[model samples]
Target: MKNLKLIVFALLLTFCTTSINAQTADEIITKYIKNIGGAEKLKALKGIKMNMVTNYGGMELPVEMVQLAGGKQYVKLNMQGKEITQMASDGKTLWSTNFMTMSPEKSDAENTENALQSNADFPDAMLDYKAKGYTAEFVGKETKEGTECLKVKFTKKPIKVDGVQTDDVSYYYFETENFLPIATEIEIKAGPMKGKKSNSTMSDYQEVEGIFFPFAINMGGQDLKIKKITLNPVINEKDFAFPAIAAVTAEPAKK
Candidate 1:
């Protein structure tokens, strides 16, 4: 009789432990979506437009961004009265033109071959990371910005960028209480910046169209402060159009 009771107790404990671990990942994901407004609300956002101010190299400049469904994105920056722009759709084609550069350069064909290869970071990507050729795993819990969070690691499949092939790995710290992504650390596997690591922290989330967005972003690497960003009010569809320069270029050249 005592043996039977002990056996049942052991089985119950095992079941509870399995249940807790199973609950953690999905629960965390669901809570995060709710904090940002439910998944339904986020799906309702057809487009996003925002004005941004980025501080880098001891200078602050205004920039703009437009994001749309079907993996389309556009970014514009005004530097010394010159407008620099970059656009991409489904990651297959990209255009980046800057008055500062002697000539406009396109990303290597392999780099822009798929939506996931594009440089733009969209919030929706987090929804179904696996299906997008990304691998994610729980890396336990840690503290960030004075808040406890779950650390998740994501690795991207090999892809070419600028004619050079590379892979990327990133660590995200999601706050436990709110499920908001608080910090990110990324490592690049190839290129001039190969083996380099970058860290970014996100904060100042604001609600827009029932979704939460980080209005401020700061990225740092190798003593390089890429930018401190602050986003503005609206985004327009026309802003995401592909540039004429990109249309003229057939394929990116080999490095």
Candidate 2:
């Protein structure tokens, strides 16, 4: 009787180990994709454009985003009547301009650093996380916004940005039952806002061209708040054009 019990216990332990190992990187990634929509639907996307309105401390600002299939991206912001732009063509080369400060800058060490950090908010990048050489793992489960979710972390492989090489970690909380990402948190790498933690909450998902997009996003950190967001607005490539200038700089305006 004692020998039989030992055999049974060993069998159960082996079964549990096998089950855990069966959860591969591909399987984990596929689950995330299916939870959103599906691989087929996501692959069908060619481009996306969206408009966002954010209110922070009683101030309203407008932002526009555009993304292409091959990891190219663009962002334009109109804050208090000042326009700023950033764009990336191959994930390495970046260009930006700040009409708000009347400064035009080419992609350099600092500009590239800022773009790499900002790319986290792009929806297209989220969908292609695996293909971009990013590693994702199931970090267990938690509750967010009254919904139970699986916590996942995306760690980017070290790469050169703005002439500097760095790695970043981003945490995402995905609704366990639905697999939709609800919240994201990232640490700033290099900037005046460096060393500060930033967060964004997603809501109001709507389907555009067979893919779902978060029409509302609330981002806040460093006493700055992005209070509202809009999606699927008309934008042209010319809007991301950078003006001829020496370097980019951010300075506090006089009061």
Candidate 3:
């Protein structure tokens, strides 16, 4: 009888601890969403256009990124009076400009699918994350960059890495005082940095059209400083489509 009582107590304690942890995570997320202009305002966001600059090879290059609500986006880089379409995707087809040839090339099947899946998180991933079949857990408090933050382990839909499905997990560190995400870390699944972790730090947050956005983003050791942000900017869909290279014509030979 004593053993049975102890077992029941253990089970109840486990359930209660789990419930408390889930509640804590949800509470933190709720506060974060509210602090960043609430869910309604975030959902009302249809598109975003950001003008940024990054230093590449000791030269500051102008970069423009525009993303629409339904996973349509493109990034254009200006280099020495030349416009380069680094990457563009119209939700289905993923393509990028070949720098050497200055021609558009479509990405492979695996990459395209992965890009599509990543872009599915419009506005923000934490908003309606549960509906997207994602799980969030409170991993306790941790200090990041001299600021105490609440860590949340977020697991989203599985993604294919080298033909094998792998967990798409990320750790978000939010400021405990303001409930704003300051940094995020995710393990790289492919490429030369396969086993390494990628970290993005955000700062200089400013409100734009009722929503807050980080004006300074450090991603993959590159700092992207935002000069301007336009919400719901009018855009042409053709910009995201693969470009048609003009055929060169040979001059007629004189007899």
Candidate 4:
């Protein structure tokens, strides 16, 4: 009788363990998308305008960013009542304003391409990933800082420059309990930080338009705190155009 009881307990434990590890990559991604919002809602998402307070070296700086569905984005940082830095893209061309000159110049070709490739997608990268020529693989579960997380890796389609390889990859860590990404890892392939890994932790998830979004992200010592987020805000082409006024003024575009 005692031996029978032990065998039954072992079988039950194995079943539970298998159940916990049974989630496939697609299933995990689907659950993650559903937990935040459904695929249909995410597909209909057109644009977003967000106000962020960035912490840098003990100083808090306010930054306003606008992003459209097809990859156009603009970011403005105000400091000392001045338009200190600005970056904008028109889906194809990328330009930026120098801090001192405030003159618009074409950004680096590699950086521009990277931004264009990454920005033209869902706020959550997992949405329609397969359709976007990307593939994801299940890497099983791991514990992060006392939290059990589902680890997954997604491979970006290979990038090339004059027949040279420049493809990059990204990793995501989603808390098993909520199916929300709490952290991400990436390695820089270009620019000054080439081949260096960067890890960011996300928390403070708040709901916006039936979707959950991380309102806070800590990367190294810098923190991005979202103050406001307006979906489908009306954005004029000029907002992302070069040669703008000395000052930029914007209000949420009427839905």
Best by TM-score: 3
lDDT of 1 at 104: 52
Supply the TM-score for candidate 2.
0.67
The estimated TM-scores of all candidates read 0.71, 0.67, 0.93, 0.81
Q: Which ten residues in a row have the lowest lDDT in candidate 4?
A: 159-168
Q: Per-residue lDDT tens digits of candidate 4, residues 122-219?
A: 46677888888887777778887578998888787666543466765788888988888898888866557777898889999999989888899888
Candidate 1 per-residue C-alpha lDDT over 1-255 given as tens digits, one digit per residue, 9 for 90 to 100? 999999999999988876665466556666777888886776666566667777657677777666665567777777778777754453445656644663555655554564434443454656655567776666789988898989877676666655655666688889877889989998755568866877888888877655677877777732212233232325444445454553565688889
Candidate 3: 10-residue stretch with minimal lDDT: 238-247
Who is ahead in lDDT, 1 or 4? 4
The models' CA-based lDDT, in order, is 0.66, 0.64, 0.92, 0.81
Name every residue pair that clashes in candidate 3: none
In angstroms, the error of model 2 at 148 is 2.0
lDDT of 4: 0.81
Ranking by TM-score: 3, 4, 1, 2
Error of 1 at 89 (Å): 4.5
lDDT tens digits, residue span 104-177, model 3: 89999999998899888988899999999998899999999899999999999999999999999999999988
lDDT of 3 at 65: 98
In terms of lDDT, model 2 sits at 0.64
Summed backbone clashes in each candidate are: 4, 2, 0, 1
